[model samples]
Target: MIKERLISLDVFRGVTILFMIIVNNPGSWSFIYPPLKHADWNGCTPADLVFPFFIFIMGTAIPFAMPAKTFDNAAFNKIIVRSLRIFCLGLFLNFFSKIELFSLEGIPLLFGRLAITFGVSYALMGNFSLKVKTYLALSIFGILLFLAFSGIEEYREVRIPGVLQRIGIVYFFVSLLYLKTTQKTQLLTASVLLLVYWGIMALVPVPGIGTANFEINTNLAAWLDNELLPGHLWVYTKTWDPEGILSTIPAIASGISGLLIGQLLNRSLPQLEIIKKMVIGGLTITVLGIVWSTIFPINKSLWTSSYVLYTSGLAILCLTVLYYVIDVANYKRWSTLFLIWGVNPMIVFFFSGIIPKVLRMIEFKNPEITAKTINLQDYFYSSCIAPFFNNPMSASLVFAILNVILWSFILWLFYKNKLIFKV
Candidate 1:
């Protein structure tokens, strides 16, 4: 197998991750530049492209990561374990700062408790029979069931579908799809999903809203969140989520587009010819997406079909530029900064959030005449960044840029140490 790592793809992923860190950790939300902020309801913005671009990178990287055309039992088991690990990591991050770290209110927790208890009890019992272990496990499970249902709400108010969770979910399905089907089939599947989502949004009659519409709160996606998700919407919105369930369908389509591109690159073609074809394909898809938006309206929150195409096309366009510059032209001088970020994308992203959250949680006496307390993050932003810029928006932008620069250095250290975390 002629396997080679694509420097262009790494740079692309690094750039996307960098932008993600910047937009997510603005110095002040209210003072953000318009381009950095997400589109309100029914449009696409640079901020909105980050997530889909990462998804597209995931899909594109899979073919390179797993070069096999078939899945055996061992491969399938590995896939399952990897998916679970990624999903569990996301769940761990979700509960990292939650009020309830562990509660015996769910069956999963109950079973987990039972297993631990049974192991301890069985050790004390001195080599218990299989029959005895079974009885003990069952007894513990029974006790857990009663405690689990004692305080039940009809609907869960909080949901934990973070960015990592969405990435994990999309990665699992798309990776499995790549294993099971050909590139032609993947393209067809993406088309079907996009068309189906478009049809659903256009035709489905949302209750109490009369005819279906694509407006912010009145859209079919928002309606589904209200009916199905209810209290489980985004904490900020409390009604709809940007990365809601139905929207994931098109997000997966975005990933599939990357998968198609990845597979295309595997073909034995001239480098210049491949780059030219990619540019042309990306342009065509982008145009189609813009035309489709006339009817569907490309909304980031909805993860509308047209938005997927547009974002995916943009991703491809960006990738082609990187490929042409770095690969075709053999330009490697200035790619190191992004390459460092690319090597440790997951770790940088995780710590980017964790460090900010930790800093925000740590309060100190305000270094001012008045008696006041402020989080370290706010203090640093005000002292280090805000005073320099007359415009608050410029300060906010600088703060975000500083965050990107800070992470680049941190990731550089990890790259030097070879401490990259993949999942």
Candidate 2:
């Protein structure tokens, strides 16, 4: 059996993370290519595949991280610590721009979020005669409760469902599911989850909206977000959340699909046999997804069941090719480039978000107009590329690609230094 982590998995994840940064930080949303932008509402795009791909990658990593031992104290402790660390980091990212440094709320808010997430996760991990962990967790919880009722009235949204938070939550459940079940049972559970989600969206009536539908704000998923989340929905769509509650069911399915493939890869089989199975299985799943989409629709925002299968299928196919070429055939020279981002995904993702915001914040007095100020990034783009390219779209693409190159260099340093930032 292969004892090491797959080089192809890391490369696949690196490729996914690279696209994620590019799509997310385009020079101008207005000037983005059609494929770079998310589909207006329903349907999938290259942009739509990144988040689920990350989630799928998370699923594949679980077995390597947790192993097949019973949920012992060590295992429990590891899961809680890692989940809290990741979740708190996410909360801090959401609060980074809004808080004031000297004010009580600034750095403390960041620490407080970390403490709260850590404490909650610790408490859930079972008491192992560790009073310090328990007390710390309680203290964090108490601080959060006080802050909730303090009525400080910040500009941030009430219930911001962050990308990292969703990943953490889905990861927790799916990883736990894998630990508790056999492979056969896991596959069945995933199928049931996808089917149940389909039934709910297709059969259940949306109150006041009448029948179940896939329309923009009229769908079951949107209604659940509006009703359950209320003021916490995505700022872009106050009425609905792309990573909303109801849609998470299918998202979990995407993770399970990856987990299934990961388990397959781990089996005692020849390399060519593994790759052949993945290619054939992926094509079959892809065809089934297409047929199901006739009724359910492969919507990325909604995370429809069809979308889960379709994306997972593509992910499997991609990984198969990468594994065969890079791992089996010993073609690993190019793998180093991808391994940089793949090894330090969270670090790349977090800094990618922070750097752009920092650049945008650093405004300079416009050279052309004394009273006007322009963002540093905008100035660089306008001067360096916009004038050269007649199409703003081309310039925007150049800016995004440049960001990727810059981040790739930064990640390469981390890879060289062996500075992977694991949750």
Candidate 3:
């Protein structure tokens, strides 16, 4: 078994997480830099690369992660459970905001069950004893359940298709492919999926609309999402979801791209040859993606076939450079920061999101403005940051930078103490 960890991969992962945090937590979304914002339609940007990059990295890690190639009942159960947990985590995020913290009007008895339950569960993700973790989680869960039954609240429709949910679905499918198939088979599967997706989008007629088209709302993927998920699509675009059902097929291919890379990385080949092959393959795939984009435009929202290939190729190229610099050439000095983030990504991601929501929850009346209150983020940005910068975009960027720095400091403490959150 190849048990040795790759420093470069960790650094790459850490870099992705760092950028993800920065882009996601901008002080003002309205004032974000072009590179930090997602493409509105059929194009790729630096911001667009983050999710697929992580997905590819995750796929590349799968071969090294699996305990056995042969599928046992235990292994199958473990995989399913892990995928479900990830999905649940995403679902939990959907519910996090809707859970009223201090609201007495609705579900007063069940005051912030999701937050309380999650806080207790998150605490258990540490290096605690199994018994302790289980007992505490169960205790919190029981309390939450009791409170939930005490008061019935109006239900809010949840956004099901999200980054984490897509990741979980991709992981499940790709992990199975990795475990069961040869490298050639995996590659074939990915190619077929991309081709199949392209075909479906190009040819298959949508249900309500007769012709198939890749419009923002009327596309086959979007239509299917609206049909199957209905009220569970993304909140931003109720008509369509970026991580919709049909799009997940190509997303699986993105993961498979990583799995193939994982297989290659694990092989007992010369380091120089590995790097050379990666560069060549990455560039070749990238060109193919670009060529194909002329026919089927590269859209991140649809998780288009071209977009998958484009992002996966870039991910490969990025990893190749990282591997050579950090691993082959033994220049790893600067990677320490990313390594801290890579190891405990889940903790940072979950809490980073929660922290912003927590800030919103902890809002107070603005003394300067009568009959108006402000959130922690808004107040901090306006009072401290916005006043300093002439450009609102600069201030927004600064706020995002500050967020990244805060996480770095927090993660450094975890790294120093060796307190890893396994989930």
Candidate 4:
């Protein structure tokens, strides 16, 4: 059996996963400082880099995790299984936000909505049910109808696309590209795609409008996202989407860059040499990113060219540091916590969404207060935990630290049992 272990990569992935949990599960979303906050519109933030870095790490691991040689039927099958499993897990996460599987209100409303919409649309069109074909048509029509008729209300918020959905779509396309093109060709393709996106965003004037200023409302990216993926699917801004279709172009490039790095690492270069190369490459890309920001600002929402380079460079630099300390120096002691996190990232992310919602649903009444009820999550954070901390920030940090510990223990159990839940 080929021993499938890249200590450095594992450490890098684990670190990124840990940060993702912290930034995502803040004790109070409202109380986060500027670094934790997502970019308002076109600028980059630390939080904004987290998701892309994770995706980049995913790409980096493909070489090790995937079959070593030819893309045979078995290899293809593995990819299909892994991709579908992750995609379903993401959809399930979304489902958890909607309904408790056993509760009265926990009906699979998303599926029900699709079923009803497709059934009606097909019945009206007098077409035989064609499974996914019918559902796809109906889903598109339903989204368009919602955009046209539904006002900007809470009900319509359900229609928007999301980060996981974007990841699914981008993964699908990038995998196809990987299969069709050579490694060098894929790199070229990524470069061209980024350049093309930059050109379109900068030069192509919106129809019936002429202005150089690319403000949130007036920019072509926002207009296209609104026109194509309208309604509540817009992320940060109602008029714009952070994971819009156009922005995904550079996001794929980010993944491709990771794949290239993966290819380099696969070549059996010296560990120290690899670290040196990574440092040099990362610093060069970072400098280019800074220079590019002069013209096209490093905007995370847009997934701007500069932002992609900057984040990719930083991600590589981080991986290099992890590589040096963990693999080269043989420092295995400190990596245990991150190893637990890396081994079960998907499970942790899924449960993070589920646990908070389940806790919030269960209410506890205080004896001293006149029937004052607190959400279970709040009770855990504010009552038992907050007293130990001096201030709100400290309390928040404690909550996040506890969350990490709780989830890390759960992951440790799986790791101890040698249970690797792929996809």
Instruction: Show the colliding residue pairs in model 2.
Output: none
Each model's lDDT: 0.77, 0.77, 0.82, 0.69
Instruction: Kindly list the per-residue Cα lDDT of model 1 for residues 1-423, writing each as its tens digit.
Output: 424688999999988998898899888999998889999878888999998999999899888888866788766655554454444444334333332325644444435534543343333232345445344434543433333333444223445455766787788889888999988899999999999999998899988887878887887788788787576567788777777888888889998999999887877888888898899989999999999999988988888999999999999999999999998898978999988888777666555655675576567688883498888899999898899989999999888888888888788888899876654
Question: On residues 1-423, what C-alpha lDDT tens digit does candidate 4 reach at each position?
Answer: 322667777777778777777777767766665776788766778888888887788777766665354666655554554444344444444434433233334224434544443343333233233444334434544544454356534345443445655666566556656655689898898889888988998998875567544576777877787787666455346777777777888888888878777767766678778788889988988888888888989888788889888899998888888878887898889898888788667666655766676667666685447579877787777777777867776677667777888888888898999876544
Q: What TM-score against the true fold does each predicted structure earn?
A: 0.85, 0.88, 0.91, 0.81
* Ten-residue stretch with the least lDDT total in model 4: 98-107
Error of 1 at 222 (Å): 1.9
| Model 4, backbone clash pairs (residues 3+ apart or across chains), number | 1
Model 3 lDDT vs. the true structure? 0.82
Could you give candidate 3's per-residue lDDT for residues 54-169 as a string of tens digits? 99999988877784577877667656655655555665666676565554533342346544646744654545554554455445434433443444363235666778778878
TM-score of 1: 0.85
> What does the lDDT come to for candidate 4?
0.69
